[model samples]
Target chain A: MPTTITVTVNGTTRTNEVDERLLLVQYLREVQNLTGTHIGCDTSNCGACTVHLNGKAVKSCTVFAVQADGGTVKTVEGLASNGVMHPMQAAFKEKHGLQCGFCTPGMIMTSIELLERNPNPSEAEIRRGIRGNLCRCTGYHNIVEAVKFAAAGTGGKK
Target chain B: MVTMTSAPFEYMRPKTVAEASRLLSKYGGGAKLLAGGHSLVPLMKLRLASPQALIDLSGVGELKGINSSASGLSIGAMTTYHELESSVEVQRAAPLLADAASQVADAQVRNFGTIGGAVSHSDPSADLPAVVLALDAVMKTATQRAGRDIPVERFFKDFLTTALRQNEVLTRIEVPKLPANTGTSYIKQSNKASHYAVVGVAAVITLGADGVCERARVAITGAGPYAVRAKRTERMLVGKKLAPNVIRNAAKRAGAEISGSFNEDVHASAGYREAMTQVFAERAITAAVANAR
Candidate 1:
């Protein structure tokens, strides 16, 4: 049976009819037309579907849309304000944090959440923070550097 | 891409432990208890398990939090790994728990995955089962009618199986407090991508005066049907001094202790897991010895 759920996304309230099995990633991409939350690995191994669920970063692919009902969600697209990208996003671009940007959105979103909880993480902590997210292109050197860059700028916040 | 999603099941989000237990008892093998769904959801997506109903435990408030008393630490079944990993009380009382919890799937998974669910699921490759076994923890379970506590040694029945009855729900895990001068370590060889341990070993040892081992409890994961205590290794280490040769001998004994077949999945082979188990046993015991000082 389809369930009626109301969720707040990107600062906008949305009420939609969704199947019980519909994943949050699908709801974001198909229903809301928010493609910024990419689904890299449906098995939850790839962190490409990372998004903020009530201010904590989680793989949207692992969460059912109904499970997210009444919760606040923040996708990669929601991080920007008025036209400015989040500091983590800007840091990724400035530090060459992408070769094939498929994993960049999830990486940036996850890093944003990590820094929120821990503003100044050591190099080892940064690596441990993103251990769930996989990036095959850049070998994570630039991603680590990007997080560091953002941490130095605004102490890893917006 | 393969379709990775749970099969059609009657999902009921019961608001109380009594309600969930009633559903579990009525559904028999057709119902599964869903705590964080970290273990069950993945298997459901893979079609390995197709229960007719899922009793969601997330809404049950009684199964959450870490409660401590003079007897020991009692962690609710719904207490997420994130809670255990970051809890100041856990870090202070059972620091090894925080270490083990920190290495589970990842931040996102840990945020939802619960300690009771992990131990109850009985994944041999998981990090917590061995740690709990080494700590001599007790698992508490309840049905609508009754409740009971099972020791960790008897809690894990076999691979992907636990002593929890079909109608019973795991409610809490009790880990006893170690005496002063006790040290513990958890060493795991994780699959870099999945974060599941390829081979994990946890050791808790107490040192007497002159650095002789007074008590040793060693448990190993990812090398057998279930995480098991290295009885031979533990027996050999007691009353022995913390020396390189003694630790190496005990570690070797731990490697030889496993006689059953191992998981032959793509992550590892039987031989490779055995070898890594020995390596981790050595590392964990050595680290525990150092920490004892």
Candidate 2:
């Protein structure tokens, strides 16, 4: 049987009729037309589908939509405020943190969380913190720089 | 074939533990309890685990919280790893749990994975099975009629199988307070990709008044079918002073508890796992002793 669920996504509340087995990642892209969350790997690895559920980053692919019915989700699309990019997003753009851009959204999502947990993280901490989200672009040098840039504030090249 | 989504199944979200237990009884083997869904969902996606129904216990209020007393801690089964890793009470009561829980997987997994689901799944390579076994945690379960408590020694049965009955829902795990002068540690060589432990060892050691070994509990996981106590190693450490040589010799016997052949898979070969078990056992015991006060 299909269940009616109300979930607050980004800042908007959405009500959807979903099957029991629909994954949250699929629900976001298919039902809600939010494709920012990408699925990079079948095994819970790669972390390409990272999103915030009730303020904690999680793999959207592994969670059932029903499980997240009453929760709040923040995706990459939710990062911008009134046409202004989130600091983490701005940092990524400033540091040239993309090659193929396949894993950029997940990386941005995870980096924002890393900074939130540790306002000023060490280089090793930044690397360890983003270990879950993998960028196949193998451009981790700039990714780390981007996180540091965001952590160092919006100042130019701190 | 590896797929990305779970197969068709009925989903039931119960608001209470008793209702969850009743749902489990109603569905029997056809029902699989969903907690965190970190381990089971991946299997379901790959078609490795398919069930007719799923009973999600996330909404069960009774199955969530941490109650502490002089005796020990009663952690709700639905508590997430992030909660366990960050709880001040858990850190004060059983710091080894918080340490091991923090190292279970990456940060994202820690946010959503629950200790109960990990323990119930009994994946041979999971870090918690060995940690819980060494800590001597008691699994508390509920059914339609009553609840039962099963000690950790008998809880884990085989690969991906536990003593959890089909009709019973695991409610909480009771971890006894560690006596004074005791310290514990868990160490694992995780697989590079999945981060599952290839060989993990957990040791809880208590030193006597004279600094001689008093009581020791050790468990090994990933190298065998399931986590089991390293009785031979524990027995060796009971009376001897935990010098470097004695700890090394005792660690050599850590693999004696495997009743059958060692687990062999893409993660590690049998011989390599057996050798690494002894290595990690020594590391875990040494680390435990260093922290023993």
Candidate 3:
């Protein structure tokens, strides 16, 4: 069966008839063509498909797209304004937080939510905050540093 | 193979609990209630569950929020882990539950997973079951015909099973506020990857004016088919002061109530969980006793 859902993606409000089975991650990638949200692990474990459902970070694969109906969704592509990098994105680059970059989008999305909950998180808090996300490259040391830099919020350009 | 998407199913989001109950009754076993979808949705994707319809409970206004009462807290079934973890009232009233909610899976799962959902799903390794069990919580459910309140002791039946009927929806969870001079703690030997407790224990200990043990509620999870109270341990601790030696001896019987065989998976062998159960029970009781004023 098809479920008609009206969702505000990033900032754009749109409605579509979607299969009830479609995952939020699949909807973001296939229907909207917003490929920045990577599916590093189709299962919820890797946290590669993390996105903000109405400002709360969730494993997109774990949520059916129909569940996001009438809600706002923010993805990695939604982070920046007018091509300027979001502080998190800039921090990842400056702190060398990626090797293969498959988990970067999820890591960044999850960290942004993490910093929102605890604006000034410690190194331990940052690591625990992003535990859902897996950087298979074992780039955690730099990833932790990048999250710290992002939480610092002073280095990224406007 | 990675099955990323759920199978086809009809979805309905009702505004009231009564309507949802009616829908649940209509579909009977063909439908499943969708709370946070942290458990059911994942099961659907893996093809383990293929319900014909999903009655999404997120939109039921009555099924959300936390309310304080004379007895304890009347928590709406849709209350998420994040909500429970971050709620100031929950922190003060049932800190053990709040802390356990924080330790479930991780941030992303916590953001959406609900207390009612977890309780209804009844995953043996889930942290909340043991906490609720130790807290002597009450689970309320509704159907088109009537509503039933099942005590936590009778709530969990077996592995991935509960006393909940097919046509019923768990409405809320009532967790009691700990009395003054009482303290509680939940500790677990968790799987490194999934964070599910291999052997978990939740202890609630109240001290008398004389500093002797007044009452104790100890529950263990993950070591067996489902969470169960360590009645022998609780009985052993009630009249006596909780010393390390006393607690150690009492905790040895913590897994004795696990009927039939213990749960053995890749994460833990039966014998390993049996040993860890005693260790965690002792640690949890010691921690709770220390926390008591």
Candidate 4:
């Protein structure tokens, strides 16, 4: 029997019927239609399905929707407020942090959390922080620059 | 969407260790303990493990903490890799352990996976087993029948198998404090894509007066069916001077002592893994010796 789980996504609370085995990525993309969180690999190898579960970044593909019941989830789509890009998103755009953009959402999400923890991270720390997220298009030179750019900006709004 | 393809099993979330043990005792082999489910979930997705019941230990409060004591350090079974990596206690007592924990699968896997789950799962490629063996830690297991402590060497029995019997739950891991002037290092060659260790070597060495080796403990992972101690290399180094020549020779023996073939998955070949094992052993020993000094 499927369980009804109530979750707060992108500042909206919604109740949905989720199978015990349904992954959180599918729930976000299919049911909630928040396709910003991409699923690059069904296995946990790819960080394309990254999201903030209770303010912590996690690969949604590895987590069951039911496991996130009653938790607050922030998807890539939630980063923008009033149609304005978040600082990390704007930094990526300004610095050309992405090329293919398939891995951009996850990369941005993970970087946002990383910056939150350590605002003035060094180049090596930034690389280590985003080591889990893989980018195929851009060689990550711009991404590192984007994180530094975002870190220097005072206003959260980009 | 990846859904559970196996037969439906009874799921019980136990709030306490006693409740979990009771469920395990009742279900016995039919029950499987669910920690973070990072290791077991993937197996179940492929229909590898189909237990009739699952006892979820996520709610267990007793099995979660990283604290130090007069004896040594005690890490709760439910401590996640993220917790270990950021723990001040772990960083102070055994920095190598924190380093190994940081190298686990990835950020996501480390956040969800528990240290106890990794140790109990006994995956040959998992990093903590090698660290545990090198630290000479003790595993505490509890059951409805009784509770006992098993040395890390004997805790792992075979491939994907542990010394834990049916209804037994691994409760805590007790890591002994290193003697004075001791240093440890862990080095591994990880597959870039999966981030699983292809071959990992961890060494703990204590330097005696006059720069002689007082004691040596070495362990290797991802090289065979289970993590094995480099007993021969350890014996050769003890009582010897801590010099590059001795370290190189002992490291060579350590690599040579690792017998049997490693699992040749999509990651790497048996030959490449064997070669990497030797290289990693040398580097790990050299680094550990420097730290000991």
Residue range A1-158, candidate 2, lDDT tens digits: 88988899999999989988888888888888899999899467898899999898998888988888888999999999999999999989999988999999889988888888788889999998888988887999999999998999944331
lDDT, candidates in the order shown? 0.86, 0.89, 0.89, 0.85
Scoring only the second chain, what is candidate 4's TM-score?
0.95
| Position A57, candidate 2: lDDT | 95
Candidate 4 lDDT, tens digit per residue, B162-241? Answer: 99987788999999889988989999988787677889999999998688889999999998878889888898899988
DockQ-best of 3 and 4 = 3
The TM-scores of chain A alone, one per candidate, are 0.96, 0.95, 0.95, 0.96
Q: Tens-digit lDDT track for model 1 on A77-132?
A: 99889899888889998999888889988999889878887898999999999988
For all candidates, state DockQ relative to the true structure. 0.49, 0.63, 0.67, 0.42
lDDT of 2 by residue, B1-293 (tens): 11237788988899987888788778768889999999999889888989898899888898899999999999999998988988999999999899889887788998989999999999999998998999999999988789999999999999889998888888999999998999899899988876789999999999998889999999998899888899999999998889988999999999998845799887788999999989999999999998896
Better of 3 and 4 by TM-score: 3
Task: Please give, for residues A2-23, the per-residue lDDT of candidate 4 as tens digits.
Answer: 7788999999999998676677
True contacts kept of 2: 0.78
Worst 10 residues of 1 chain A by lDDT: A149-158
- Score residue B196 of candidate 4 by CA lDDT: 73
Ranking the candidates on TM-score from highest down gives: 3, 2, 1, 4
- Docking quality of model 4: it rates as acceptable
Clashing pairs in 1: none
Model 2 clash pairs are none
